[model samples]
Target chain A: MSERIVVDPITRIEGHLRIEAQMKGNRIEQAYSSGTMVRGIETILKGRDPRDAWAYAQRICGVCTLVHGIASIRAVEDALNYDIPKNAQLIRNLMIGAQYIHDHVMHFYHLHALDWVDVVSALKADPQATAELAQSLSSWPNSSPGYFADTRRRLADFVESGQLGIFANGYWGHPEYKLPPEANLMAVAHYLEALAWQREVVKLHTIFGGKNPHPNFLVGGVASPIDLNSDSAINARRLSQVQDVISRMRQFVDQVYLPDTLAIASFYKEWFKRGEGLGNFLCYGDLPATNMRDRDSFLFPPGVILDRDLSRVHEIDMHDKAQIQEYVAHSWYNYSTGKETGLHPYDGETQLDYTGPEPPFKQLQVEDPYSWIKSPRWRDKAMEVGPLSRVLLLYASGHEPTRELARFALAKLDLPIIALFSTLGRTAARTLESKLLADAMQGWFDDLVSNIKRGDTRTFNEALWDPSTWPETCQGAGFMEAPRGALGHWVVIRNGKIANYQAVVPSTWNAGPRDASGQSGAYEAALQDQHTLVDSSQPLEILRTIHSFDPCIACAVHLADEAGDELIKIQISG
Target chain B: MNALKSIPVLVEAPATRDFCYQNTLPLLHEISHALRRLQQEQLPTTIDLNAIPFGPGDEQRLLEFLGRGEVSAHLEALGNSSVWESGYPGIWFIEHRNESGERVAFQMEITTLPAILATHPDDIAESLSSLQKALENPSLGHRIGD
Candidate 1:
């Protein structure tokens, strides 16, 4: 007999995601991933000024704030054939790089580490033994017996006081937990350290974008002005601050995050064998060294790797209508043509149709339309998008650093190249990429400083600032490799106003339900791949694979209205 | 050259704009639930303020309604943190800042005493050991006061 296990409102993530697995005994036979929330940011964006779209689109998610703004601005720029100054490119690179490092570090410690590390078990750890274990891994200055002792006591108090607070509801003593008590203690200590480290690094975004979450963005360039003498601009003091943040970021990645990931992986080597869902990966490259138009200058190359083939990387063109399309077959949406047909984002339509069962129900009607997220397929194939995809793409593209880091980590864990497809590989890849981006940030900072030294202080190109200069009808696609994976925004502007705007975010590619032809999305397939429930109620195994993708359902699904009148209303009490 | 003088005054004055989404009521309801839990079960609850989005003047309104209590404290660690009790007993507000003086976390902890205000047992043990060492060595004894 087969039983259905449901994990709803998956905690410690940005938005609501529900996972249901059909199991035969201990192993999962089939899995269904559903995004329950609807976000109609695209509907809210219709007929708005193309240049001002970034400000509104930036509100799609609080976590991946800068990515939507970047994609939105790039779409407008692409539509208008706008060109920004070289200084602007370098500054944008720094900002994007900062987002990756800050985001990945935060995800590893705060979001994903609990799946592997048992917090309650840390109380049993000897402080001296933990200190020795931490020292053997890395010379992170705080590796003293006293420090570990202090951390252990604090954790013990919190656990003993019956106020687990954030640590409550965790699968504490699950048999699936493989880490030793000392390792758990060490990981818990570093988790606290990462919280402090992340705050300092995000100051880079504030220095450049003039804020952290929902930073200011420009259509033709960055909003920051480069004036060495002025305090308000990207002056000498601010540039130095940027440099400081980069160094701090690099230090943490090298000393703490990377070492800790490897330490944790060594204990759980079996994880690399499972969670290798659909072997296909996709990346719409980002961090252009020169201009957005010049694809050759991109640090992370854009391409598709099908069947885990590192031999030949297929090219991806966002502008090609047939290349990228979204399917609404199993989604709570409708395509104007038909539910079976896929539409390119430029012609993408957001129609509010909820065919799923009403709320407060027992089980979702899995045979019918079950999810709010539309299944985005590249050339009608489900491809995984995230750190693992980017790392594989970089390694296949012959990026020397990624190749070396992958080799080093594989050698340390004594795992083969095929292991990169599994859940642990996905988590480790995030740490590796953080190191890569942190190092690349320094070079971008240097280039920006040199550009200013050469007396090229221009950050914005005023050529396309005037709306009157634009063509009457134009459409373009803007894409970037966000912290999660590939993020793209499509825009059609007619008479200086947005005619159509659609964003195919990272989560949509990974967390969408099965398609029309009965193809499983990334999350569903990965869950079906050798996942067993030790305790069906405590589905720690499911969380491990899903969190590896770092699902952001809010970015995937947008709000919709049946009447198309009032999209959302906020009730106020005076 | 004074760098401060070069900054242009971009705004003439603070714009009086109405922020439509008032989150104060829901937050107050949450506080009420926590207060009830404290009264009935004697279990403390901490609401992470960072997790909740505050509209324009919503935070100010909530704080004003909570009012101020007699107890407040300042603590320095990786950065500075502030803790204070609200007019309603057992409702405490805590704000943690980073070294750059940026607010990293804020919470409305409903308890008799905020957790950070209490000294850790490990720290107390370390203090005892260090004091014992100082007493044992007359030369190092003066350094304790210093």
Candidate 2:
């Protein structure tokens, strides 16, 4: 008998998603992954000032708002060819780095932890052992015996209070909670520590953005103007705070994250070999200089992997718009054959035929097919992006720090020195990346400070060429390393105003639909090998594990009421 | 072939937290009128762009400010902070609480003609001068908030 298992409204991860897996016996025979919702972000952007898109783009996804903000700005700058300032480049880099650290921490603890480590299992943990684990790590007082004792008390309080609002729907003490009582105790302690630190560190963004989730970085220069006097004083505090938070986080990664992942991963050593997606990885390089790229967009050097054969990723010029096309033959968007990125919106040529096929990634079934995301391939090949890609690129380029971090992390996790290119290697890869980036932030920070001391703190460039400054009226593509993965924004301009703004989001690449061939999107392919589903009610654990791929679907929600929907006139019917 | 005595350009606001149709609804007619008046003067329109395309942030500190996050996603929605919208990078600050006790998050919009429309070099110089003057000085007659 065929059983239809619908994991509707997949929670915890960003955006609205539903997974339909046809079960044959105990295994999932086929899968249908549907994002199911659509927001008219592209349609709304039509006929607006191009500069505003930078401000507009951040709303795409909370998980990677910085990516959206940068993508939008890069698109406009790519069209204008406006040179960004060096100080601004460092600031952007730091901000993006913080975002990566923040996102990964959240992805691990708040989202993915509950899947492996049971929340209720903490009750059975020996508080003394937990305290011992904490105190043994650098003799830190924050995780002392007293702290664990109190943490145990708080857990009791939470259960008694019935105000376990955050943990309301949690599947605590589930049978699959794999770990020793002592390890669970340690994990519970660090979970709280990570939460507090995550909240504390986001302030860096607030000081600059006036808020955090989606910060505002001015395109040409820094947004918060340096009132030389105010900056010297305020920056001292801000910079110190950033360093302190980063160091604290580093300790947690070294002491807690590494230990927790290993302790837990050891219990489920089976997963160490499963869920590797596509085998083809892609990463657009980061750390763009102030000048950006001239023609080939040396900003994010593309990194592509076809099967096992890896190639240096290159930018597809927006001028040659024909090269970058998205085929929705199997997507929710039913186009008239193949539609280019410049025109792939719902209204443009969308055909909503749910009758297309199962897991649309399988729709083409050749090389780059499967998934709802429009399979975004550069030069007709599937590519992988994000931490692994970054690590690989850094290693290939002989970045010693990244290589060292990778080696150290592998040693701790008891992972083989296989150069970190496996399905189960994502966790180690992300951890090592966090270390590399945390260290690099200091390097970049010192560089910026030295440059500042040398009297080179210019922040913006006003492009007013010798009368022949209409920017040649051509198209340009801007690719940047979003905290999540490969994020690219393509723009085609005609006579100054934005003619087309195409954003192939990180989620679009990672959680994309199938390409022309029958290859699974990154996330879809990753889910195929999963033989475990503890409880159907909590697909969240699995979703969290899958979403660790860091898929940010920005245009998943759209509220298109009558044009005059009095938004703030709260008719709070008491 | 142009007998346009009085023409007004309808400039739509970017899909930002502030300047959304929801927040600016009460004064839509006024904004439309102000936009018409600015077009007659021929200046680049001052507008609010949508800083975020998704929901508001789960935590307020995530609402970093550049030029965006100046508006609140809460005020733009129907309920008390919908997760779908709030999960996006959104913010809404209360300048003054409204009548229903639901505070209004607004954008200070100053619509002028496009700055690039100055026909001559002197005209361009004059246009920039006037634009800066307008930015520094908000016309009392076109005032947004009370």
- Per-residue CA lDDT of model 1 for A42-62, tens digit only, reads 878878999999988888888
Worst lDDT window (10 residues) for model 2 chain A?
A565-574
**Cα misplacement distance, residue B24 of candidate 2 (Å):** 34
**Docking quality tier of model 2:** incorrect
Question: In CAPRI terms, where does candidate 1 land?
Answer: incorrect
The positional error of residue A241 in candidate 1, measured at the CA in angstroms, is 0.5
Clashing pairs in 1: A38-A558, A38-A559, A39-A557, A39-A558, A39-A559, A40-A558, A40-A559
| TM-score between candidate 1 and the true structure | 0.81
lDDT of 2 by residue, A1-574 (tens): 7665666556667886656665666555555555655665654554455666677667777777677787777766765666777777777777777788888877777766766676667777677777776565444456666667777778878888878887787776666666777667667777777877787667667765667887876655567543223322224445556566667666666666665665666676556665665666667666654445632333334455556443343343433434444555446554444533323221123434344345433223322222345666555555566776667666655567766776766676676655365544666667677766676666666666666556565655555322246553544456677766777665555555555555676666666655546555666666665645666554533554465565455543321111211111111110
Which stretches in model 2 have alpha-carbon errors above 4 Å? A136-140, A231-252, A289-291, A294-301, A309-324, A337-372, A396-398, A417-423, A464-469, A530-541, A555-574, B1-146
Ten contiguous residues minimizing lDDT sum, candidate 1 chain A: A565-574
lDDT of 2 at A266: 65
